[model samples]
Target: MKLAVVGGGSTYTPELIDGFARLRDTLPVEELVLVDPAAERLELVGGLARRIFARQGHGGRIVTTSDLDAGIEGADAVLLQLRVGGQAAREQDETWPLECGCVGQETTGAGGLAKALRTVPVVLDIAERVRRTNPGAWIIDFTNPVGIVTRALLEAGHKAVGLCNVAIGFQRKFAGMLGVAPVDVHLDHVGLNHLTWETGVRLGGPEDENVLPKLLAEHGDAVAADLRMPRDVLDRLGVVPSYYLRYYYAHDEVVREQRTKPSRAAEVAEMERELLKMYGDPELAEKPALLGKRGGAYYSEAAVDLAASLLGAGGSPYQVVNTYNKGTLPFLPDDAVIEVQAAVGKSGPHPLPVPSVDPLYAGLMANVTAYEDLALQAALHGGRDRVFRALLAHPLVGQYAYADALTDQLIAHNREHLAWA
Candidate 1:
């Protein structure tokens, strides 16, 4: 199989290569292409990718290109990991929201909405080119604002499925806590991407043998600590919320904390410099330990499994993925993209039946779903009013004054990318 990574110049690519090398049997890649615009970073990342494959004794050849079409042409699958604007833009996304007293994040809050606007058009163009070259190829998107991006891909009629490491990360953690293999643990992970909850963690796949209560009883502090939420909140909610929720449940506190710390984008920018330096080294054969702190933990395994499953290279029947709601939540529109455990195979992911959602989670999910609708509207057909409306609908920026201020800041920061503005 030929597989293409659209943002292979990224420092994160080697970690993906590590997974591809280790799970070589699962994906059976014969030609791997790394596509990116940054030639210097591409060479560095490409060299390291080849070394990683060779060190793992894999036969697949690694190719690097700045030409998106050339890199993706005839590939069996294309993974979209591109950042439309690099960390410089992300720095702006992470910084200016503090001016409005809202959480500034790359994949949540106003920043995530900014990412969605910048991303959807670029991704659609690539998807169209991929379709022209390899109509049968599956597009596995690992982009931020995945819910919005995946929705755009599907709406534009691309053969695509959004992937993220968050679910796999949770499964790995829950398994470690339960003293079981990661494969043996199944999470009832549901909601939009980045805004999800682990309603259940089952020992058996797709079975209702929930051990979440046991986990909470024995490791409440640990679980709560991981989420950076108080143990009492978990006890009250009876389910684990994604760390992103902190921006909602403790908005003012998070904004205050963010104001005190250097932007994560700045930290990651520095980390990327160190990583690129390492990638340029001829002797470094394995993914560096420092890469772990850069985020997207377990991304490789998640990407490989999702890609393989979509291509009918079957293993586990159930994997958590971002796909249509299809009435899984009942409260949200069927077309809304949600991340949930699904039976993935050749036909694509069929979301497993979800338990009835509690009002607390469902209500917020519905609200966000509405906000995402407007967010995409603003993305597709750019207008200040639409952007303002989306921000107003967002639970994080519900007030008119904040929405007005955020809309102006978002547009100002993103004007270069927004053609209509």
Candidate 2:
């Protein structure tokens, strides 16, 4: 099948390639199209994809293009992974609000809303082009403010599903924290990207009932077992967990400690810069790592892995993403593309409906819904007040009027970026 990766020039392209490479035998990718605005980066990913396929002794057509239309034409699946304004824009997204005495984080709070407002228009353009070019193609979107962009794509009447490695990665990590096999620990995951929580987790066996809360009661052991443990997420879900919780729950405590608060967003930008420098001249670098890793990398085995899984080359269940929750989950407005667990095959992705989230995470769901509504309003209407109301409704901004002031200030300060003052 023809699978096209839009924004294939991104630094994360390698990880995706790595992810798919390991699945090549099952997915048996027939053709791969890498689309991006940067010709050099597109060439890099395309070159990597071709090399990975050959190393595995698989023959697949790999094509790179700057033309979006050319890449989407007759595609069976399209992966959207673009950064509309790049890290520079994200830096602005984070820094601009900080300058106005507001919390500055991309894909959350005021900064995330601003980022969404700016990005949705651009993402929709890509979706529109894909729709016009390949009516049957399913768009696998991985853009930040994913909840916003995915909803916009669906609202604009496009076939698309949002994707994020964060959620599933965290799910598996939490399972590890609980000392259970990842597959055996079934969870009820909900909420928006990055802000989501696992409301329930249980051992898949017969001893399922009450295991999650019992495990959570042993917080000390869980924390010691995994420093990366997201105890806060667990606490929120009222269970044991790992990952973003280390920072998310400690936000207030970290500030009290006078230490550098954990910021994956800042780290993401810095790593991108370092990797771009390394990729600029692989000869000067010791080992190259893409995504969050540093150095010692192969051409990447991920893309092939995905291809293998798609072609049905495995016995175990493969994690392939399919869009679910369009009509089922009322928490998110209809058309918000939610990335959930799915089994992939020749028939494509079949989504798994996780259990409903808790009331705490339900608040986050409400925030994403607000962001989605605001993104749509920003796209279809030019009302800054509407955007303001959305921001006001956000949990982050609920107690911080400064966030609102910052939002207003940002629009005035960066009128060109917001397309209004």
Candidate 3:
């Protein structure tokens, strides 16, 4: 099968290449193209990707190109991993929102809306190009603001699925704790992308066995440590919230913490510089250890499984993915994109039915879903009012005063990325 990575210049490419090398039997990528506008980084990254494949004795041809049209033409699948404005824009996204007492995050508050507005337009343009090249090709999006981007793609009628490593990462962690394979750990993971909770941690499928309570009873401290939450919170909720929930569950404290630290983007920028330098070393054949600190752990595994299943490569029948709700949550609009367990096949992901959620979780999910609606609107039709409304709808930036200030700050910091600005 052929695969194209639109942002293959990314340092994260080697991790992906490493997975491709190790799991050659699973996906059998025949031709891999790394597409990027930044030619210099692409060269370094492409070199490392080649080295990775050669070191593993994998014979797949690795191609690099600055031309998007030629790179994705006739590919079986196209993976979107591009960052619209790079780390500089992300730094602004992580810092400006904090001035309004909102969570200074790249994907959770006013910052997330800013990212959506900048990203959606570019992604749509790319998706349109992909359709022109090969209308039947599947689009696997790993871009940030995934729910919004995936929604944009689906609304435009593209065959797309959003992938995030969160669920798979959790499964791997839980598996290690249970001394089982990652595939054997099934999760009743529900809610929107980045904003989700593990309501059930089962062995095998949903009908197999529920070990959530047992996990909490014995490994609560370890699990709590991973989430950076307290054990009591896990015990109280009978569920584990994704780390992104920390922005909501502890807004004030998070804001205070963010105020004191350097922006994550800044740290990542420096790390990328080091990674690119490492990629230039001809002797370096494996993914560097420093890459783990860059986050998005186990992303390649998730991508491979999703792609293999979607391409009918014969993988698992079910996995966690970001797709339309289709009444899975009952409360969310059927068109609204949600991340949850889904049955996968050549036709694409069919979201599994999500069980009833507690009022505590349901209320937040509903609130966020409404905000996502407005966020998508602002992203599709750029205007100050749409931006203001979306921010006001967010639980974290509900106050009119904060919303007004955040809207302006978000626009000012992202003027270049926002065409309407």
Candidate 4:
């Protein structure tokens, strides 16, 4: 199949290429198209692709182009991996809104709003191209601010899927912490892009049908006690928490008192800076994966899994997916595009009904709704009312003096960006 990797110049590009090559035997790739605006990045990814193709003795055609039109033409699938902005953009996504005393984390607060504003236009432009070029291709989005991007694509009437590994990754960690195998663990989870909660988890098997929650509730304390500082806290969160989630949830009083304080965002930024310094040196860019090691295992396996499902290589069960709510979320507006269980096939993604969300869960969805609406407003209309509405709806922000002050502060600090008076 012909696969297109957008943002081909990204740091993760090599790993993705390595991932595809590793699976070439089972799922041979016939063509790869690399798309990016940066000449240097295109060259970097192209170089890696050549090496992989040579090493694997694969006969696939690798095409590199700066033109979206050329890159997307006749593609069977596309991996949307572009960052709206890189690390610099991420820093802004985290820092700008916080400067105004509003939650400033990327994919959650005002930062996500800004990201959606910038990204929506770019994403729409790509979607338009894809519609004209590869009309039938499955667009796999690995972009950040995923919820918003997916919404934008859906609004524009395109075929797309947002893929996140965090769900399965952290769930497995939680299972390990609880002394159960990953496959045996079952969890009910819901939340916006990065902010999610595990309503409950259980072990599901012939012998363990009723033992899942019991294991967690009974052994949770000891499991929490045994893990290192942050991981232990993550254990108490019910599911193994992601490194990114800790930044937001850890600061909450309940989370902190529970001894699951999150690592600071500033620390994450500094670590990123260090990595940039290392990669700035051309010497390190040429390193190879260790012998016998799978390259880009994190995403490649998922990509292969997606390919298998799309092609019906195996009679795999339908995969759950996130799509427009229609009625998936009874608590929220039917128009809301919720991430719920779904099954995918050649016909594309179909949403599964989400069971009722109780008060606590409903309240969380309400908060997310405001955040999502604010982003949509920013992306579509660039309005202050939309932004204000989002913040006011946040559980963190209330309809009192503090909320007003936060609004004024944000508007005053970033007048250029803030559309609200």
Quote the lDDT for 11 in model 2. 73
**Candidate 4 Cα lDDT to native:** 0.62
Q: Model 1: runs farther than 4 Å from truth?
A: none
**lDDT-based ranking, best first?**
3, 1, 4, 2
**Steric clash count of candidate 1:** 0
Instruction: Estimate TM-scores for all models.
Output: 0.99, 0.78, 0.99, 0.77
Backbone N/Cα/C clashes per model: 0, 40, 0, 7
Candidate 2 regions with alpha-carbon error over 4 angstroms: 174-181, 202-237, 240-270, 280-287, 294-357, 399-404, 412-421
Poorest lDDT segment (10 consecutive residues) of candidate 1: 308-317
Task: List residue ranges in candidate 4 displaced over 4 A.
Answer: 25-27, 56-59, 174-187, 200-211, 214-249, 252-297, 314-320, 353-355, 397-421
Report every candidate's CA lDDT: 0.92, 0.61, 0.93, 0.62
Candidate 4 C-alpha lDDT tens digits along 1-421:
7888888866566667776777776456789989999887577658766766777677888889999888899888888888665656656555554444455565655556556666777787888889888788888777767777887788788888776655565446667777767656655555555655555555662222444356556666654453333535644444533334444454453233333333234445454344434444544433254311321235655566566566555422333245577766677776666655456666665665444666655676767776786667667776556556666665555454545555554455444433343
Better TM-score candidate (1, 4):
1
Q: Residue 6 in candidate 1 has what lDDT?
A: 95
Clashing pairs in 4: 202-212, 203-212, 319-342, 319-343, 320-342, 321-342, 384-420
**Model 3: per-residue Cα lDDT over 31-75, one tens digit each:** 999999999999999999999999999999999999999999989
